[model samples]
Target: MKRFFRLPALGLAFTLLFSTAAQALTPDQCRDLLQQYYIDDIPQTVLDQETIQQMLEALGDPYTQYFTPEEYKLFTSSMEDTVLVGVGGTFSLTEGGLLTERVFEGSAADKGGLQVGDIVTHADGKPLSGLTLDEAGQLLRGEEGSSITLTYLREGKKHTAKLTRTAFLVPTVYSQLVDGHIGYLDCDTYGVDTLTHFVDDMTAFSGLATSWIVDLRDNPGGDYYASMGTVGCFAGEDALSYLLDNQGKYSAYRTAVESRTMYPALVLTNENSASAAELFASSIRDTGTGILLGERTYGKGVAQSVLDQTTLPDYFPDGDAIKITSYRFYSPGGATNDTVGVIPHLLLDDDLADEAALLLSTPAPAGDTTGYLRVDLEWRWYIDLDQALSPEYQEAFVALLEALPDQVKVWQGTGGADGWTQTSAAALAEAHGLTDYTRRGFTDSADSPYRASIDLLATYGILQGTGDGTFQPETPLTRAQLCALLAQALNCKMPSGESQFTDVDMNAWYGPAVNALASMGLVNGVGGGRFDPDAPVSHEQFVTIMGRLAQRLSMVMDLAWQNRPDTAGDSFVGWSDWAAEEAWLLAEGQTGLLGNSINLLWDLPQDIDPDAVTTREEAAALTCTLLQWVGILPELS
Candidate 1:
């Protein structure tokens, strides 16, 4: 059932101190805690382990770790607002030494003239070239008031500086007005004070900055409350994420603070961005408040709960504790970011992402040139319609550009590059009057092999884009999302009232679709009154759904099994036993529902792996093929 938790004042406060000499919890106690709180089902083999460490190892969850009193103290300190006695800069390990990534203003690193990009090769006369990032950091940090000498390289020249280490609060939020028009907020971590700092910066840039860029690259996430509040500054007060526990209970985690005046935002992320950092990016992107740029984020969607004496007094009389994975969280759109990280709207090199955002935010220059159309699909796409080309092509392009809805602005631009628009192949075809346009403007699907199928489905209003102007064809299609698409394709009447599944909220965008499919007996819940809606649908499962859909539509399959192609029987061999019959019916020539020969669903060299997850493009192709066979959509020329 849907439940709500009172947002805690301190989202993950680990402040209770423990004695250095404390006894460790027994294996049985550890197993019991895990059994009660862990998000996933624990195996009997894990419970059979003899020691606490062995049990945790067998559990195979890296995030769930048992810590002694001393280790726990250190862990808690790291999670809290950090106070470090070290050189005031974040460094990334490189072949030569540590490459300075960020230099805090008015700090020892800044005062020592250690600019970003400078390599710190030595610390206190000790060479740091072969050390790990943590080892290098340890060498640089010292007790407060201690002096250290750092040798660094700048522009291929060696330099030296002597600086004293002092305890300073690690800055979580860094803000500045970029190019006097873009408000740049760089969050190193989402600590307790991050939200307040972000608000102060937003208030400062209220009138001056027209656009904003949030940089979360290399940010190992911090406090959950702080992250949610920070995202609210852009996306407004809303349920930013949904958390599911082991007991089949779901909780909506909403933003705590009021939103600020919103503007066009570009959120930058990288592989190092994890946990709460991912939450911020996903919330912003899913809410349509901004576009994500840079590499895919580090996927860490599960939240850990700290178990100690205060929470479980009977089991833990000693100071030692265990941090156990308690809940698995999903994005605002009901997609889990656990193993699948958030994909950016535009993937660009880390160093070039900021520059690209700046260019995107800047307005095009005034009328110096004409006969050029600028298409704004998240990014700028300048197309020179007047370039030296055939008149028929130009006429078709002009007609296509003109046919676009008022929402997608196509205006005059200064001609630079020749015909460089981000318009998808499907959009161009539909615009040229070849197909009835349904406004499925997905710029990212131009090069997809399934472009034809995607275009057909989109033209018929059976497929949809990811709201942010691109079709993430490679992204895995979730069960709930697939259900929504199927409901649209079949034109199922929307079911009213509450959803049958406990995890599926009726108010959610996919709720009615799921309920409609469930009411039709075409879909089923995972178990325990839950749908597991966010889980990716496997290939065999997707085909099985299609078979069920075909049956529900009362479509006839008169072709006999003996009349099927010679390769069809072999093709069905690899499919799961449960889905084998349905899979064979949909293969190639059996039901005339799938492609044959050259465009076979399970063609050679790319033979079907039944357990593999179905991608959005694959789903589109299969759905489009079915719709065409059923006369819902026109067959491909």
Candidate 2:
């Protein structure tokens, strides 16, 4: 949808001078052509430039391009078997607008006497107004060893600091103790030397590290093999990534051959932690080597292919570099990590925790000495294990779910004109040619809020509407639809084949859950030769599914299930204090928009009509949402 237009000088040259009368190339022919072009662009003299261009157009690659003379250095620089060096300073623009936060943990700013609260108004004589953090970054960054002057306001006084930038090989490994002897590591980038660096830092600090925090925040990416092996340090020599070709065949990849387990790790990341960061985090967590902290990483799990690097120097005119998505990667557990970032174990605020840090800093010992050390034992480390479980996942889902009651106001239980009983469940029967059937399900469980829950759940999956615009709740749930809902609510293992069920095929949308529900003991075959995967499920079946689902989710919900000392007096808003570590509360908000429904005293997910015949579209919405909720799918593209 986004189009970028250059001068089109090259476009004209490509069309007339290079493109040839096109012919439909077979997939194999396409691969061969690309390999040939990449390995060597020079072709038979009979093969005109136009023919080559036309042939190339047959293949699709968005990141694909031919390098120019000027881009040679850039190409070689990125693809080189070395790390990219930069001036190491993390900068920030203040909320009030003129001041900037320049942090030089150990960078040029530190050596230049730039303090933490310094307000940078200008960079190299250029005003810093209206410039975003990235723009400011660009002005601050220059070639290694270059000098830039920064004008700053320090404590209501103006000052200037000129600092010469130094080439910094971004060390992939960082370690320090945070929160109760937990080691915090900021491995921002993974390169060929990453594994070595990680092992060295960890091994050196093994004596003190009870647990660790690996910060992958803001890491773009580097070599795949290098990054995989880096985290594999904790997971041992295990499968880290799997490559699936266009044919859907999976090829597994393991880290460098080794076997070792270090301290328990907790990875910290944000939306900016990307590519190798996501890949590496998922590998470690899926393999049970660590818990993920912070937020869901920026997922970049696709593998890129480099073409023309081995040859075609003359055509490239620049140093050869071409990286395109060779394929997408799956986690060691076989879950697709592309687009959907690795979901975090905890979500943290984007802003730096400066307020908390400053508040904890001890006041200078009786002042008299202006330049005194403030040794605040409390400020010495930052990390809270209890904070990790709250306001992050479970309750967030519940909150979102609770917000939906208003959205479904039209659907009433007894309104024959259009009700919860007429829309969501009966749609399955109508679509699958079961017109005469009545919906055979209801419940008086707890507030008898069954119909209300149906309205909420159905609408969230976009299922709570009928052909005549009805919401019929009395309809019996269909087997296929039940599978669909189950598939969405839990991690539906993508099937390799139409499991032992002869009735279902890979094309069946619900085939994924046929084996899953069966394995979970929530479903059983009806009589001989009847998987009844498509037949209407009974109310009895619904209760069974609900109980099993409750049991299954109990594993994930344990941390969310808090002890409420006073159940009678507890209300949703007031429960946060009692449910200090509320993961389930957040997850409830995510699933079906139950966000505001946190005040419930019941373990409600246990009571929903699991046998309800969720529609295909509804199943898609549900499964996709739950996939994101459970960390199996991406919440953002």
Candidate 3:
């Protein structure tokens, strides 16, 4: 399917029109077709694109949508600032093929004692049966603060209940303290300045002043910018964020201003604080701005820009109504803080907190790896001038990306280091020195073509087959994976040193790799936390990683190759990470790598067989593309 999804400056412009011979489906008709097929299983497959479009025009409403959690996040962030949650009401087609019953559970109807057997004669005084159940339901669902008055027949009597629509803002933030002195700040919402508010609230703690806690108790966020602003306060005058886009470039930033707190801060987060909040808290903690105390955080590193408006296809909806991913953002240190949230330093739970404290106060009970690990973990996180990063190349090597892929077509098929999968696979192989050997895949017994490709890559040793031999491919690649992969891909030679990223756990398998990568300016994680070892990776994510590496290795490797006729002409320029000239390699298209770049989605089909693994055929395809990008392999067929 030749489709184009544009992330317009204002946001996504989904023009699924036939510019050539393709037919134009009016917005209305498109909406109807989707709804019809999605609901009633109606509508023809293909036709004169125009005829298909006209049919779309016949159905007037453009506001309805069927969404999963991920899709809903995109829809609400850019289109409708408010998304729907709890069922407003459910109705079925009557056996008479007319209007049968309307049930509103937990809504005013249910609250007012309405049931499933009831028939609604009118909604806000309008006849019900004439309106499709969806149309009626649409009228019922709306922005919070709007009221809907429904008149229904219950027990043979007509009754009315005026209900107000509210934005179902999911409350995910939880806060509390452990022991004494550790004032915990659990900020889960990037809900428009939630981080800032969290910081502000932290400043308000009037209690004792020893060690403080900032807890991100499974806090899924509301926005990225808000997350950055929140994290900025703690990060101080250090690069706290970066943006990643599809073109293999990133725009990095630091907190130029001063930090708010002088008091030592301890942050508590888990595999839940995502997006902005994750970015904010992770940066400071990683910098050892304070002690990060908790389990690993939920890694959600991709950033999405809502269209000019979030209430999509509704009033004032863009004619090109769709959510297009634009860019990804990250913490100050150069790190792929994607699906991998923050890992903790203390690694303490309520069960062990007291014992750990005594262990700290007293001594280890026996042959204690625990005490040794704790000390090294603290050194990795809290000490400045860490051994992992060379004093000279710290900032230059690590880069926080600018934006996520506005378009994810960063590679040709057949996997390679450029795409997220290859980026991940290659890193794992390199880190463990299994580059010459093949291992198992991410999954087992997959018969699909994609799975075959994954197996091939494993066989070729281009991609490391996991220890278990099954590629849990969909499991988001972790920050540690990216770091390990980058180091391995670049043929990274580890320097025996202290950890640089405050989040790196010295005892962890990826610890040394994390430090080396951080020192080289490859990737980072949220503040006050350790680098999470497992998380899924995204398209834009690896681009930023490559961008950082390209710059660091440029003038040495990638630059001279770019000026060749291969990069400048003969269609080679079309490559996602390709620059116009060799000089533009580090500068990222002369506008500079950190400039206002954007990319959200690409032309790749999402109908991926989830059960499949990455094969060598796929690896070769991707590897060839990346090899070309890194100036290693030539452009392919």
Best by lDDT, which number? 1
Deviating ranges (above 4 Å) for candidate 1:
1-23, 90-101, 109-165, 363-375, 378-412, 415-449, 452-542, 545-637
Off by more than 4 A, model 2:
1-58, 63-76, 79-88, 95-107, 113-162, 165-189, 200-211, 245-249, 257-261, 269-274, 293-301, 308-325, 339-341, 346-637
The order of the candidates by TM-score, greatest first, is 1, 2, 3
Model 1 over residues 1-637: C-alpha lDDT tens digits?
0000101212332323222334478877887898999988999999999877678789878889777766666665554445556677777777999888667666688878888779999998899999987678778777888888999999999999998877666556767776687798888777667898889999999988777889998777867788889888987887557777898566788886776765867888887788889888878776777777666677787888888878877776767778899987666755555544565655445555665455446544344435544656554544443341244344334333332333344455434544333444345545445443234447787888888677555544456777877779999999999988987776565878878999999898899999988887778999899999899999988887886665433213322333445555355767877676567666643322353332325333238788899999998888876654433332221
Write down the TM-score of every candidate.
0.56, 0.48, 0.36
Question: Model 2 Cα displacement at 564 (Å)?
Answer: 48
lDDT of each: 0.69, 0.48, 0.42
Q: Residue 416 in model 3: shift from native, Å?
A: 58
Better of 1 and 3 by lDDT: 1
For residue 485, give model 3's deviation from the true position in Å: 8.8
* Total residue pair clashes for candidate 1: 0
TM-score of 3: 0.36
Q: How well is each residue in 539-630 modelled by candidate 3, as lDDT tens digits?
A: 33444455445544322223333444443423323333422232233222322256652221111323322223323333323332333333
Error of 1 at 570 (Å): 28
